[model samples]
Target: MATQTPREAPAQAGRRLDLSAPWWSSPRWQEEKRRIRGELAALEARITPRRRLRAVIRTLARHGLLRLMQDRRAAAPSAGDASHGRHPHRDPDRRLRQIGRRLRLAFQELGPAFIKLGQVLVTRQELLPDPITAELAQLLDRVPPMPFPYLAVVLDEELPDGLQTFAWIDPEPIGSASLAQVYRAQLRDGRRCAVKVIRPLVDKLFQTDIANIARLARRLQRLLPPAVAASSDLPGLIRDYYSSVQSELDMRIEARNTREGRELVEEFGTLAVPEVYLATRRVLVTEYVDGWNIKDFPVDFFTFEERFERMIDLAHLYIKEFLNGRYHADPHGSNLIVWRHSKKVYVIDWGMVGRMDALHTEAIFRHLLHIRLNQAEDAAEVMLDVFEPTPYTDVGRLKDQLRSLYIRYVDTEQAGPHNWGHLLVEEIRIAMDNHCRIPTGLSLWAKGWSAAEGTARWLCPEISYHTVVESADVQILRRLLARRFNYRANAAWIAEASELVATLPRRLNKILERAAWNDFKLPVEGRLSEQATRNLNRMVNRATLGLISGSFFLGSALLAALGGGALDRIPGLAAVTTTALWGSLGVGVYTVWRVLRSNKA
Candidate 1:
């Protein structure tokens, strides 16, 4: 076929070019192209089949599930197998212990991702079985340090010119973990610092393993019981894990977190945060703080009173951070150090932090206020407002549990020297059991508080966390009231003075007009007659009863009318509506009979 050239096309237009649309411009073709492109993009984004298969295989092998299956099959009863008659699984205690041991080993073998998962699982004792959670609690992140040459290569890549700034860098690592290794180094300017280098390939491995774990978690959520699923949001857990891993992988982010934490708690002269010298995506250099881990610090160094005072100070600091909406999410004993000579507490490893919204902060403040006032019911109500309730939540049960927990911990007449951190943990567990979702920030705060409390307790067994919190509450209340009073003294005085000045003329005119009309008089009062008072009390009682009955009746009717929607879907709405209706009828009958009896009398 012969085609017309561009220059000749115009001249050939006289022959009438075909008016058909091009294929690419056709609507049908465009739609098909978009659909194909979408499909290809989705396929590319999804986990590859080979990668999925490999993950599954690795999981099964590392967890010993395949070996367990083999053992079960080999132990299965056969015609010639007489020993099969004995049921080894009859003792669930023994079987559970064996499973826990195997699971611990499996997590260790699976490396960092699984180890981190296990560490997280340890805090979910409410959702997981006790044995499993207990075993997972023992999972540690300690690992053999990578070679100095490899770490040097990473430092060189991260800071090519700046690497020379260090005069002496120790080849031996002081500590090593799944993600990073730390070494003591001296700068050319003679400043001693700790250099942390992220392990090569850790980020990539974490991405792959996290993806597989997330997929597995989704499947597990579907297969688990309703209570388990409600208690443990696997999807949310995976998301939080991803966030924490991303933060830890970026040394710059950690450095920022450290700086912010230092700024937040700098008011407390006894507390310290390491100063960051150099920060990069994979390398962090911070001032090397020489101190004893809070866990291992000798208690005899400080007197009992000094230890108690320090504990109270530490508790106050944590409470202040919580109120300010910035909290250290991980304040474990290892991350806390007590300086030997200065006797100051230093917080390290600021890889994970949490923030609270204004609403959450105010709610928590009110909750603590109620606790301090010994209003357990009010405290429970405030706490309920802080957490999100699920469709299956038993609000009454949750409230009751919270009230009881507060009474047990905060009510001094009922208990002595209670641990506030332990109480918070128990409260969270209760919330979980009742299908309430605690905010992530609040959960982290509670966990950090618990760890801090543990360290304090270890230092002084006689220290009481509840007492410390109560003291802090008093101080905070005083500060808040003082600030409020100061504001009112400055701002409210001007408004009040202006209002008085505006009303003074009107008041004077009214008084002068009344005097001119001779309407001003002093009034005298006589005691009310008994009959009039009785009538008034009767009317008030009737009106009060009527209002109460009306409210209940209206509420019940609304619930019944809306039963097809939200009311019907709720687990116990019907019972509540029925109770309201019956109670209203009972009250109405009692009111009517009382009026009749009074009239006859």
Candidate 2:
């Protein structure tokens, strides 16, 4: 990402063997993306609501994705739009692949927000078909770069000293993708740095697009069946991801991420992070990490053994850093480099970062470690302790599901560095299934692992990710255990404990005195809450009804037994008996129905 190289061909273009290549390169997709760029209506937004809606439908149709909207068993809505849907494609893989291609095309056509959505979908790999992830791969990085002139205007406006702040700046971008463009420059003091400028007006664009996306997600939530809606809380997922995307829009946040990373790596000899020089809402100035992008780093520079060592070192470095509560969320090849001379790894582009509190990070480690030790139930307990279950969350079901995952993990062959990334993803899927709103920190943690593990794979395909992490686990645990014994870390806890001990005897004596005086009574919650009151009133009403019915029966039976004691006052005792019996039966049936309905509600 810190090189002078121009953007390369789209990864899809070079993937001839990809199941998605045909749809990706199709003229239809190109036209769909370019066609129908509607201007926003003047009324309260950056995009016209109606045009955006139609454009979505049209794009979905063009890509044969409208079928997703229509009832699956029903006939296609339009022959042109649902051409592929009719096939039913007896081969499930082909059907999924086709759906994946169409969905990717539809997302691309919908613009930046949807493309970003596809990127999120790929991250939940366990929840998606491989075809889907493969087709929608690396979308965040694939957002087309904006023209340099516009970005330069942003730079001049956002920088305190204007263009004169930099001794010289190469207008040509060293890297550009997602939300910003990177230009190489030298500060007034002659320290070479990278100037990252947010793409002009992207803030407004993302704002408008995300608003529309939320609208769509809401509609999907309502329109989809209960089972489908529960399986994927579209609105909830969009909200979580968009919150992070919104954070990414502000360059100051990215600068802060860089600053935090810089601090963590200061003590790491093998790892380096760019130092932040200056930051603004729209611009970031940081030390220019001089190295070849990891993917393109020359093969001749290191021996296989050295490459393996660096890979292990990189993995270990992130493990420690993440446990400390900050991680580079997108450590892909482009955001990483190998220093030309020092041979150390340079982590660049700290824009997309994930952070967790110490407790959560410790929980994640404990969860994984339990799994490593083959204590499936303990691992489940560790995670369940952290998961925040929802109204729909079945704790028992969640337990069963988590245990099943453990079983699968045990049965499956281990591949790809012990597959911690895989486990994180599975947890996410399980969380979603049970309506557990896991902290964003966990999502970011998983993202960090996925990207880091992937970059490790790219550097040394034979690298042992699990083995590296096993050693890392020992070190990580050691550091945590040592922190517990640190006086500084436990000062507040020790103070609290001391106070509690000092007050113990006094508190106990007061309790005993009150007990002897018959003044110490357990405070029990009264069964007089609003709901409890309502239930009591309903019971009283039912009892009164029964009392009235019994009185009527007794009166009628006495009258009949006395044989018209009132001397012709009651001529139809049989009719009276039948009416009372039927009426009482009706009342009892109604009461029973009411009780059942109330329980259901």
Q: Judged by lDDT, which candidate is best?
A: 1
List RMSD in Å for every model shown.
21.6, 12.6
lDDT string for model 1 (1-601, tens) is: 0232222322332242221224323464446445544654564465454574576588667767668655445434556445533755444444555566677777666556766777766655455556666666667445655555456556756975645657656566777777888877777788989999997666655777788888878999899756557666778888987887788899999999899888876777778888999999999999898878888878587777767766766778777777667778667788888888788888888877767775677677778678767899999988988878876677887898898888766543212345566666677788887877777656666767777777666756664565667677776676556645777665877899999999999999998999999998878745444468778888897979978997998889888887668766788888889899989989988888887887832
- Residues 178-285, candidate 2: write the lDDT tens digits: 667787778878798898887755666577777778887898789974434555667777887888788777889988887777777776677788788999988989
Clashing pairs in 2: none
Model 2 lowest lDDT segment of ten: 1-10
lDDT of each: 0.71, 0.71
Each candidate's clash count: 0, 0
TM for candidate 1 is: 0.64
Q: List the candidates' TM-scores in order.
A: 0.64, 0.66
TM-score of 2: 0.66
